[model samples]
Target: MDILHTLNIASSMTATVFRGGAGIATHPAGAQPEMLLELYDFEGCPHCRLVREVLTELDLDARIYPCPKGGKLFRAKVLELGGKTQFPFLVDANTRTQMYEAADIIRYLYSTYAARQRPWYWRIIEIQRLLSIIAGLPRLGSGSRARPRSAGPPAHPLELYSFEANPFARPVRDVLCVLELPYILRSTGCPAWGASATDPAPGSRNRARLQARAGEISIPYLIDPNTSTQMKESADIIRYLLRTYGQTENGQTKK
Candidate 1:
């Protein structure tokens, strides 16, 4: 990564630390998914960040539909389904529940999937929300703009193995959100083994191992099952998405 990019990521990580890692801890409850939970949210929204952190803490995974501001797609779907543009909306296929607001969603996730006892720290939802907003200020207006192209939809939903706070992965998530593509978000959290001096960071070694299992050592790795394509690097992923799914200059498919 270039120095600037590295600094940007480091800055984001610093923000999470300042916020006391509010949304980063795992729940005593374990992973349990009969059918994937679905979330309609943008990457940079503070409200959305709260719910995502809970998902990571709970060690659960979900199908994410990126709903960036002014996104032509998915935003309409949210209004059609939920009657408003408010975000951090969640849908649980297992119970057939749909709702909005970050606090409500976090409570539901804990009640439905986690063990009975609630964490006292999470009771301060409003405080967390405010801090999340403060935390998001530096990365303002990112992952919120509409790009000027449209590629055709994929034959299958792509898969992204990532955690919410990875600086390298966040930009890729932003692009995917703006395009409103759905993907299986496999959360690769910290390693079962401890961190080391040679490691990229706390979870870097595990992320690399998981990527290697999928045939790589880098991230933000992407796998397009539709085209049998897989690659690493945020720039390449964005270029591929625009080339494949983004509209041509004439406002139609490239080909």
Candidate 2:
């Protein structure tokens, strides 16, 4: 990797420190959205980080639109729809509600989907904002700008099996953010706190589904139905996304 890219990945890894270790922990929501929730936010935004962290806490999947500053893809769309450009804008078709502000969005998700009040820790708006900002410090501007797109776009939204704080998974999400590609975030973080709990153990009650589908329990998996591809390793997944969607000289994909 180039110096800039290496620094970018290293910065992203440190971000996991402030994420409260929920990235790989999936505490299933009481109910999943009938339609996937749509979130418009960039990776490096502190406000956006709060919303995504809550998503994993609730085990809720969303179709994320990366609205990095100066991004041409989704930022404009958010402006036209919400009447102002904002970070962490949430569109919930289930309730026909589209709104901004990270705290309000977190409350809505927990109350509506989790069937409970928002967790006490995140109920403090100021605390959430402060921590999220600190979390964004390491990888400042990494995922807050749109990338150069040179290849054809995917026919459909991709699916990624990940949790927010997974160090290995952060780089993949960062790439998607810059590319402004939407995907369903399948969180596979374990619920328990023991050593073996990091993996999707049987006690989590979700591991069986993963084992049956993917043949083993592991995360940071990328399943691209657009190309009929599924992969587990983080490094390989990054390379695959870049090869398929990255800009190359002469407008041809890397091969």
Candidate 3:
């Protein structure tokens, strides 16, 4: 990797540390929702990061609708659904519930799916939120706002195998968020404390699936069904996304 890219990954690692590695470990989930959960939030939102961490912890996959600031698309949908533009809005179609507030979302996910209560520190709402904000500072608002798109959204939602705190994965997610591309986030992380010591944790179904499908396990692995493309490497993914979807102000795809 180039020096600049290496530095970017280092900053992303710091974001994980600021949150004390919340998304690195997994917990058991009790029930699976019939339909995929939908999350309307920007990647750069501190509160959204908290919810994403819980998602990784519980290994729950969700369809992410990136609602970055100045985004013209999904932001309006959030307003129509929740009556305001406030985010980290979660729509659980199975339960017919749509709501905001990161703390409440974490509680609901744990209670409904994880079959347990949230971690103690997560219950300390204000303090946790404060720390999340600190964690997000290293990102320099990369995923907080929208960027131009060369074309409309793809017919099929892209698939991304990612864990919330994966430094290599974060930049890919940032580009997806900025372009407001909705994607199925397959939350993948270590199933236990030392799971990383093993190449693919025996307990990690996502990792197993990735290995079986791609012949290896690495993230953030992106599958763009729109173009029938699947690949690994964060920088390569970013470049492909820009070439395929991203646009400059003048409406040409960035090369």
**Cα RMSD (Å) per model?**
4.4, 2.9, 2.0
Residue lDDT tens for model 3, 33-141: 7899999999999999999988888888899999999998899999999999998999999999999999899999988997777779887989989999999898888
TM-score of candidate 2 versus the correct structure, residues matched by position: 0.88
Off by over 4 Å in 2: 2-10, 22-24, 193-207, 249-252
| lDDT for each residue of candidate 1 in 22-93, tens digit (9 for 90 to 100) | 544333244376998999999888899888887766656788988888777678889999999989899998
lDDT of 1: 0.73
Q: Specify the highest-TM-score model's number.
A: 3
Cα error of candidate 1 at position 5, Å: 3.7
lDDT of 2 by residue, 89-146 (tens): 9999989999899988988888888766776787687976887788888876677777
Clashing pairs in 1: 149-247, 150-245, 150-246, 150-247, 151-245, 151-246, 151-247
Q: What stretches of model 1 exceed 4 Å from their correct place?
A: 1-11, 22-28, 191-212, 215-219, 246-255
Between 1 and 2, whose lDDT is larger?
2
**TM-scores of all predicted structures:** 0.81, 0.88, 0.94
The predicted structure with the larger TM-score, 1 or 2, is: 2
A best-first ranking of the candidates according to their lDDT comes to 3, 2, 1
Q: Which segments of model 3 are wrong by more than 4 Å?
A: 194-202
Candidate 3 Cα deviation (angstroms), residue 90: 0.2
